[model samples]
Target: MPKQKGNLWTTMWISYLETCLNNYLYSGIWFQQFQKIIIPHSQSSLMTKRLVAYFLINKVLEETIRGDYCKNKNIQEQADPTLIPKTIITLNQVEASKFSYIVGWMLFKLIKRDYLMNSHPKFSVICILLRSLCTEKVEYDVLETKLQTTIIISRSEFVQFMYRLESLVIELFEKHNELGSNILRYVENSFLTNLHLNQTFIQILKSSNGENNSELENEDCKFIYERCVLIYMKSRQKTWRSVNNYIPKKGTASL
Candidate 1:
């Protein structure tokens, strides 16, 4: 009786794992289709573009992370969780690795071409999505570490991206004040705690006076600079609030 119960438990666990793997495969295929049909087409309506970007970003958290996690040789060597009872499971490490890489590549492509920066609505969506992705705690710490390292290595490109991003944000605010406010709020909520990213913003703001003085004379450039200052100040406030929250009260025991 005990042997039968143990077999049943094993069967259930395997079924669960199989479902996860299959779901990952399905999502990967779907995301590929999404990018091909929706992402690259400049003819897409603003709403369609925003929806597609949001969808892709949301999928990155679960599908991309899981797919990347299983790419490790040690993890792959473990028993297949999704195998059916009495069935042999073939692990395709290459396919598994492609999941995370595809998402990263897509994002990089968007960033490289400055697509995200050119469209105000799409840029807003992407920024919010990126903030959510980076700030959220995942089950696997390795995934977070990998993401942070990627950002650091690409800091120059990212800084350039942020310059463009800030310009667009200010432009949007000028055109639609409410939308601009929302964008600033999103940035504060998502990126306030990110020290490295915040520091990069500071450097950009400081350098503007020296290198971008002429550009700043333009009306649009003036608006961008003012908006950037607002964002930087708001970020500083949030950082101090976070720090204060962590300070132990007098006589409180330190953890």
Candidate 2:
């Protein structure tokens, strides 16, 4: 991507041509089979996954445009947008579900590689990415499979991640015009109450107050601690009271 193209990537971490999503053609699909007999299956390589995603998104876009055209069409008007009959692309429900999984795997690769944070992806892009990251909130989130590994963050790194998360929450709400439900569910169900992240915050604050880590004395860290306190109070949206000594100081919830 050129410097002039896509604001040279809003975040500037690392990027591929498609992150900006300008009509840049990354590749051309060359499958010999016609659309009627294709079976949608997951793929491991990013390139193949991109093609699967392209297929899925193209279906969605086609349906959406056709629907719009239909609603606006007159009773006697032609049904097709091009006024010529073409093979209609149809997908089974189970097959359609694989699309998100394919795209999500690629998005996770982007996040794990720090592709998104460094580049300023558009809000629509952010919206899609956020949906994939936040899991559905239940009374207790299901335990992960042993096959999936957990990420271990240092105290400083944890603080930075939380700060970035808070910044994103504000950005989506203020600039994007609406708060995302997935992020809201994450904050309410997982983030505010997570023992690991909250515990990390407590240590960072304690280290700052103890004057042992001068690097953690910045105002952003201070605000993150305070904001965590505030959000903790709002966690689970219950009528709650605070416990003074163990909260901001101990990294335990006051409510």
CA lDDT for candidate 1: 0.39
Measured against the true structure, the TM-scores of the candidates, in listed sequence, are 0.18, 0.19
Q: On residues 36-85, what C-alpha lDDT tens digit does candidate 2 reach at each position?
A: 23544533665666576568766765586445434333321322112111
lDDT of 1 by residue, 91-160 (tens): 2688434423333433343333444244534344333333322222234346556533333122234334
Clashing pairs in 1: 17-82, 18-82
Which pairs, if any, clash in model 2? 10-120, 11-118, 11-119, 11-120, 12-118, 13-118
> How well does model 2 score by local distance difference test?
0.36
The whole-model lDDT of each prediction reads 0.39, 0.36
Write down the worst ten-residue block by lDDT for model 2: 239-248
